[model samples]
Target: MEAPALEVVGLGKSFGSVRAVDDLSFRVEPGRVTGFLGPNGSGKTTTLRMLLGLVRPSDGRALVGGHAYAEHPVPGALVGAALEATGFHPGRTGAAHLAAYAPQVGVGRERCREVLEQVGLTAAADRKVGGYSLGMRQHLGLATALLADPPALVLDEPANGLDPEGIVWLRGFLRHLAAQGRTVLVSSHVLGEVQHTVDDVVVIARGSLVHASSLSELAATAGARTYVETPTPERLAELCAERGWTCAPTGAGHEVPDVPAAEVGAAAYAAGLELHQLATRGADLEDVFLRLTGAAA
Candidate 1:
């Protein structure tokens, strides 16, 4: 069996009096897209830096493939990471920028061009880094990370500058990577996008692990929320008020907290109101994530 791709054991960091990351422990398994999530200032960047050996942890350790990153002879081949998209030299062309990192990972010029094409930047390979748009820089960052064809990937806010089309493309790309038995850990604030991308998640808040589980399990624990659509929304809302159930008007319906569809149907029937639609929504990752982080904060 293969080993866990990424491991964080009692990982922590501090800046003078401030503790950035507390005793955080989690695992990124092989062949899965795990989302590392938290609110702003949640120590996510610090944690990633520690994993990549860019920052020294105040205590604990981070490892890639069962060994400390520093212990790996060629860390780049074990894990490819991009914590930010701002490292390129302004004067270098995209292809040249990638070529610069190729030697560091034991690759060559052809491999650099291959990754440029893999990231769909081949056409603009000669464009100066300074003139590249934010989205293009993101692609270049990904290209640099993939230059070595590592088995694991760690990305932070990778979708930040991408357009809608780019976001869709990245979603498919990450999924393809995970499907190939590669591990992927991504941190992003775009909850909606993450919802569709990641298979599992490890959420942190205030430098502590808040929740870590499969996305399906997180959604399962959110319980159920029911939506009712009626021609007389005001009347139905009035009935809901009498029943002490919170009802908020939606686009063409009203969202009621934790009520079953049958109950909603019965209420409409009792009030002689015609029901247009009655549906129940399960808890989504975004709702659960916000609730967890908000409470922790």
Candidate 2:
């Protein structure tokens, strides 16, 4: 099989006594959106920097399009990254910034215009970046990345400061890009937003990968179970306890562990108790994320 569009194998990095990334290994396939998720201080930014060749990996390697990004025949055309949109010169206009990078990467000015339009910044292309809001800066940054029409994209918190409309636009844009047979890796802390956008997810915690799988597989792994509610929570808890089941009391009910809905119904009927509510709670991406990352809600 052909090599993945982006692959990081046993990649490691450190600063002083801090191990920023530890033996990270993953592959981002072509024509898919892979969500890179982690809590704050989880080394995601560090890993993206290493992949883009801004920071050297202390050990192992990061490969883009079957080669190290620095060694690609046309690095900018092979991989485009938007780690920090606001890092550009404030004095330059959006169009100017993209034009400056175009030639260095052998891209033409027409390509720059096309990308600016693609990112919905054509109207404001001449506005100084300093006057741009965080959302506008993000669009400009994306425009720059698309100037080369690269086969892969690496984005860090690309939706950080976007409004609801901008967020919707970004999601559609990413899906469109992936449909064009490009690999898209987006890092975000907004699990709910990304859960509906990405095809797969790689979760990191404490600089280590805790989970990696397709969204459907993740949901299956963290499957839906029944939650029982009753006025007599204490009695329900006692019944569950005698049956070797775990139960936690809520305001007016007990969250029984891993029991079937029908079984719960039968149990309540046998006990001659009125069941106020019993429903199956579907496992969501956010729940899986929290469980894997050990993060508090």
Candidate 3:
């Protein structure tokens, strides 16, 4: 198997008396979208900053292409990162901003145009960044990251402030990049957006790694229980109790644990109970995330 495009080992960071990240470790493989997810102040941004060499880690290491980012001969060629979309000069045009980084990263003017087009920003390439909308700035930031044609990408909240159309475009764009044998690590607080986009996920909370696994595996690990919605929910609960199944009341329904959908249907029918809805509840990524992070859903 190929080596991971990016590897974080026992990474940690502290600010004053507070620990921002605690022994966080994960790997981003090529040709896959790895989601770096956490709630507010969960150290997701701090961790990405350390990986891109923007912030010095208090302990441990973040490696890109098997070497520390600072030690890489051509860091820009190996990794592309966008920590903040608006962290550019207000006076400079979008094209000018990219031109400045191009020479430093050994990327040519033609490559800049290609990336601008790739990110759907070629039409506004000459506009001053200060006048651009939030969505446009995000596109410009993405264009800048791709200027070097790097094999791996580290983006922090790339979809922030984007409209629904822009968000949809970004989803397809990131998937395309990953499909081309590149590793894409995206950090986002929007769990619903990343749930369908990422192949693997790393969830953190309170400066600690909570869970890391493939999307399907994480969902399965959360368990495969069935939810039964019935007009007579109390009767269903009684049936579950008689069968030694764990059942909890949720709103008008009963969340039956360790029971299959077929069994729930059979039980309801045998008990002469009328079920409004009976279906197997597939555990979503958000459910698993909240459970692991000890957060309310």
User: Between prediction 2 and prediction 3, which has the larger TM-score?
Assistant: 3
Alpha carbon lDDT of residue 214, candidate 2?
A: 89
Ranking by lDDT: 1, 3, 2
TM-score of each: 0.95, 0.89, 0.90
Tell me, by TM-score, which candidate is best.
1
| Candidate 3: stretches off by over 4 Å | 1-4, 240-258, 295-297
CA lDDT, every prediction? 0.87, 0.84, 0.84
Model 2 spans with C-alpha error above 4 angstroms? 1-4, 228-239, 242-254, 295-297
Model 2's alpha-carbon lDDT is 0.84
Mind giving the per-residue lDDT tens digits that candidate 1 earns over 83-117? 78898899999989988778889999999889999
Please estimate how well model 3 matches the true structure, expressed as its whole-model Cα lDDT.
Answer: 0.84
Which candidate would rank higher by lDDT, 1 or 2? 1
Clashes of each: 0, 0, 0
Q: Give me the runs in candidate 1 sitting further than 4 Å from their true place.
A: 1-4
Can you write out model 2's per-residue Cα lDDT over 1-297, one digit (the tens) per residue? 122388899999999889989999998898999999998888899988888899999998988876788887778877778888768899998889999999868988888889989988889988899999999989888887777777888889999889989999899999988988889999987678787789989888877888888878888887666788887777887778777888876566667657777888888799887788998777756877888888522
